[model samples]
Target chain A: MLKCNNINVKNILCDVSFEVKRGSFTSIIGKNGSGKTTLANCIASQRKYGGSISLGNTSMLDISPCDRARIMAYLPQSLPSPNISVYDLVTLGRSPHTSLGAKLNKSDIESIDNALAVTGMTMLSNRMVPSLSGGEKQRAFLAMTLAQNTDILLLDEPTAHMDMHVAAEFTELLNRLGKTLIVIMHDLSLAIKYADNVLILDSGKQIFFGSKKDLLVTDTIEKNFNVRKIENDGEIIFTV
Target chain B: MKKLIIIFTPLLCISIILGCAFGSADIMQLIGNDTDTALIIILNLRLPRVIAAVLCGIGLSVSGVLLQCVTGNTLAAPNIIGVNSGAGFCCIVMLTFFPKASVLLQIGAFAGAFITTLVIVGIASHINAFRGTVILAGIAITAVLNACISFLSLLDSDVLTAYNAFSVGGLAGIRMSQLYVPAIIITGCLLCSLILSRRIQLLCLGDAIAASLGVSISKLRIACIILASASAAAVVSFAGLLGFVGLVVPHMARRISGERTSKLLITSSMIGAILVILADLFGRIILAPTEIPVGIIMALIGAPFFFILLFKRRGDNAEM
Candidate 1:
């Protein structure tokens, strides 16, 4: 399990403490400025934090960069569609897998191929990333993380601005991966659908963090979430 | 393919060797001899000048590529941080303040580039500045430093005849001592450039991604600044300030090889070296007996190419 102890994420994130178990699908849901992305960046070791963050028995700081990259791969909310071609960008995922002087081997190629295949982006593998559609761009980043083959993934809003069909398809893709996936999202339905555990944040503080059943029973997000309006009957409909 | 690319730099060197050796007509025959004229020109004058052009071109372009990548801005050159002006200002002041001081002039140029590099890095860190800020700081400093140089030059305008010649950047009057250091520096720098090329590409992704990939932001930036400073300093020390090779070479090479820094650096240097040698030849042949400074020729050709680069690309500058 990945553990956060007395962690105070400043700037955007407040005190966020949770345990992410192995092979569990966990999603973090929060409104804008509520610190969802901050929490993910903190976990990914991309941000400075005040408290202890431990992966299993080891401290996050204790991990080497190469080891850290192997342990976790992060996909931020903005998928930077770089100017480089898709194949070259995907090749970047092999950074942690190979040593500085070592040549890439067959297993690495297999990993990249599998990543592209799983993301359903094989046909677009050679295209420039900047030229891709929003959904396709997100898939390319997913492929990068997938190609890294890390044990834990911190995805900040894995499906933002993507249409229902694309979002559903992307989430389904993540759910099937069966990895220790900690995703930050705003969509309530996706939170309810995929999360073995759901975390809700309001104004930088955690409102709830646990199974969806417990969360909805205690404080179901209604009009406050804006996009997802839930009736008192607990019936939820998501709209732009 | 890599072998083919590695061959280009050397092959271009040979072509430059031939260009310097076998030009039209015979200046040697006209000069007072023809017997060991080829050998004399090869050893004493033509060879050293060609080597100067090749090494300086490679150094300048490598420096340009390094800075541009490290800052993640296409506009970022070693000159952006007032480094060139630092060199120029030092040269002008030494020429005015100490008139006949050769040793002090070289020292001044080195001191100028080194100090300016530290200042650029310092400002970049303190301002939480991005690449654009660094470039702006450079331009602003350069303008101020150039003003200082102009004031000094105006004070000694009549006495500083040599300064006028060097300021325009020429291969003329290169001493053996000056040539040796730049050659060694370029060799060492080329090695560093190759090793750090991949890092530059990774770095261009922005600080956050580079950090996540295990690149120490401070360390990479330091390496880049120092390396670029060394290259620009060496070139400025030898031949004064020659602009646009750094800015233009990488863009042209990127058009062919895409954005990979290592490949682009090699290609840029190759292109830059050829461009300089060709320009030097044009300077030689343009009006024969009167050699136009290669710097002016480069500016004439390089300016239009630079605008094309500016238009063809926007770079990763937006985040910065």
Candidate 2:
């Protein structure tokens, strides 16, 4: 289990507590500047939190970086310029698994291959990373994260700026993956479609936490998001 | 990758030997007499310069790539942290104050680099922050160091004139002895760099990403800064200030291959060797009777290419 209690975040997430149960798809939906990304960071142990966060049975602070990396993989929302190729970028995800000066072994190569296969990036593997389109770059980063093969994934706005088609498709992809996912997303409709659990955070507090069914209904969004109606269907369409 | 380096190694050796052999004397004359002025000049002047260039090329490019890796900024180079100027200013002081003192000059330059690295690392990056302070200080010092070097160069015209040839960054009179010591220093540092390459790659994605990936960002940054400083010092001790090769060659290497530091380090080193040798060869034949410094030619060619790439990349990376 990944747990946080009475967590306070500055300039982002504040006083939010959530447990990412093992092998469950959890989606965090909130507006811009709602501290969703900050929450992800706190969980990933990228930033310090006020209270306590534990991974499995141990405090996150107690674990080694190598050990923490083995349990969690994070895909940053922003993509840095790739001065090198896609093959190299994906290879970077294997860094946590290796010790200093360790060479890439057959298992490492197999992991990279599996990630590329999963993300459908094998064809563009040899290409330079800077040359890829935005969606393609996202897929490449997804492949890199997948190559880590960690049980927990923390994504900040995984499909925030994407077009409807790609966002819908990627939601399906994340839904099918067998991992503990705590994703920060903006699209309420997409969250309802894919998330097994929904968390609505507004200005850092957890306003609502329950099944995706609660979030898809009109009442929760109206109270937390100041929105009137969302279509009552399997897929929710939030209306202002 | 191992296979690639094996193939590239012998070719580099051939290029280096050819670079070392070219000088005032014909190859035949050097073979004939071991004690002639031609032989002496070749051994003392030309060979020291060539060896210096090789070492500088390797060191500067390594430092440049490592800095870029640590900062996750392509603009990061030894110059960014003022280490180059630190080395240069140290050399200027040693030269102006103690003319004709070679051993002291090397020590002085190395000390300068070491001091600058410490000061920058101390002020800019705490043991916890990755590189906010160092980069800020680097920008500030670049202006200050350039000004100081120019002022000193004017004041110590004699030293300046004597060192002018060194400043142009050629392998003109580099002997095995002159650069061997620095090469050894750089070689040892390179191993440390190899140990940290994977960590540096994680650090390249920015501090948050590095932290999430289970990397100690501050520790890695400090180590990288020191290694980069030492690498810059090693080169500047012998070659003075060879430009563009450090700043540009790593990008070219990255463009060809990928961003793996394990791959980048050797490839960048090889690219540096090729660039220096070709530039030195150009210096040899272009003004054959009177050779120009390879540094001048490198700047002339590399500056334009560097700007173009930078501008183009700004377009490519503007969204970032």
State each candidate's clash count.
1, 16
| Tens digit of per-residue lDDT, candidate 1, span A1-240 | 899865676566667788899999898887888888778777877778888899989999899877898888887776665567777777778777776535569998999999999889899998988788889989887887888888888888878979988898989999999899998877788777788998888888888888877876654576456554445465545554
lDDT per prediction?
Answer: 0.78, 0.78
Off by over 4 Å in 2: A81-85, A214-218, A226-235, B2-14, B28-48, B96-102, B127-132, B146-173, B308-315, B318-320
Scored against the native two-chain complex, candidate 1 gets a DockQ of: 0.45
Pairs with steric clashes in candidate 1: B80-B138
TM-score, per-candidate, Cα-based: 0.90, 0.88
lDDT string for model 2 (B183-211, tens) is: 88889778898888878877766666677
lDDT per residue for candidate 1 within B94-118, as digits (tens), equals 8887877877777688788778877
DockQ of each: 0.45, 0.60
Interface RMSD for candidates 1 onward, in order: 2.0, 1.7
Identify the leading candidate in terms of TM-score: 1
